[model samples]
Target: MISTPPPDWNSYVQSGIHQPNLPTIQEINKAEFAPNVIRLGTGELSPHLFPRERMKQIFHRLANLIDSLGYEEPKGLLFLREQLSKYLKTIGIEASSSTILIVSGALQALQLISISLLQRGSTIFLEKPSYLYSLHVFQSAGMRLFGLPLDENGVQTKMITKQKKRQNASLLYTIPSFHNPTGILMSEERRRELIDVCEQERLI
Candidate 1:
């Protein structure tokens, strides 16, 4: 009897509105959940680092104080938004509760923004070798990703000008504070420059 070759499973993943996560990203997701493995790249904290008692206290208060378990308003729970507004004030940011929109997490927030705000074929300028590369949310939504080089200071803002025009990029995404994977903190001066360039280019 003749031996048949193994099937190429990857050939089934056709490109379309939804794209599969990169092979490395899929591997990393599985590796993170493996027993005896410590996830260094993920945002999750170790069990010991979690504030268990404080969280329990908060949950206890919510169980007693929360009056309704019904679905929240479209934006989210008004009470939570109000609290978030107040917290923003303490950080020198003034935002009204009515303007606040809370989501489950950062991934959901990005997915919402990708579909709601961006048009199909829009380009997003982001730092090269970014954590965003690990996520297909934007790409799956019919947007393109353009990588901007990074230096010691942070993502090279100067490149945004020509590249923005060339790619017709609609917006930029960045993690300036303790940037994931790279761990490069953007300098204040570079931040200012980035703002200026974006403002000048009218690229939000």
Candidate 2:
């Protein structure tokens, strides 16, 4: 099968699709580092929250797998995916190993998805005042971005139908846990509502 061309990727930004930011780096630095610091740009967990000991144990176990470290299949290790699938089961997501794809990070996953499905004129819906605005990956793939309004509970699900029709969005991007810019936690009801609406609209 033929592959997508890798050239002219930057041309999208050059065409002025760059996501505009609110302020300059100097302004952010001055405010963030002022002697009278108030709040951070975003919330983050302290080092204590990381599973360092568990990670160390995992690395120790994986040390023997060095011989198999060569580039593997695109779907990632089936064993790891199987383990993850079991873990996700406890959270009500009945996923199988076949559905799990381990990418380098969320950004790479987004890049791959955007390149695969988003056309030049297509749009994707995300939350207003979102972390996506700080990224150019979707825009770099020539996707128009749409911001859905959110409240204290989370994304305003009521507006989804209206905006989907207006923007003709094919995907909805979200960072539910510890949302980057605004840390508003999505409620369980809203989560279900989002799923229902997406299902009705046939959105990804």
Best by lDDT: 1
Clashes of each: 0, 0
Q: Which portions of model 1 miss their true places by more than 4 Å? A: 1-17, 89-94, 133-135
Q: In candidate 1, how many Å is residue 33 off?
A: 0.8
Per residue, candidate 2 scores C-alpha lDDT tens digits across 49-163 of 8999999999999898777867777899888899999999999999999999999876788888887877776888999877743357887778888888988878888888887
TM-score of 2: 0.70
Candidate 1: TM-score? 0.84
Question: Which lDDT tens digits does candidate 1 get at residues 1-204?
Answer: 989988776665654556777787789888988988887777678889899999999998879788888999999999989999999999999999999998988878888888899988899998887885434778788888899999999999889987877899998999898888889999999999999999999988
RMSD of 1: 4.5
Best by TM-score: 1
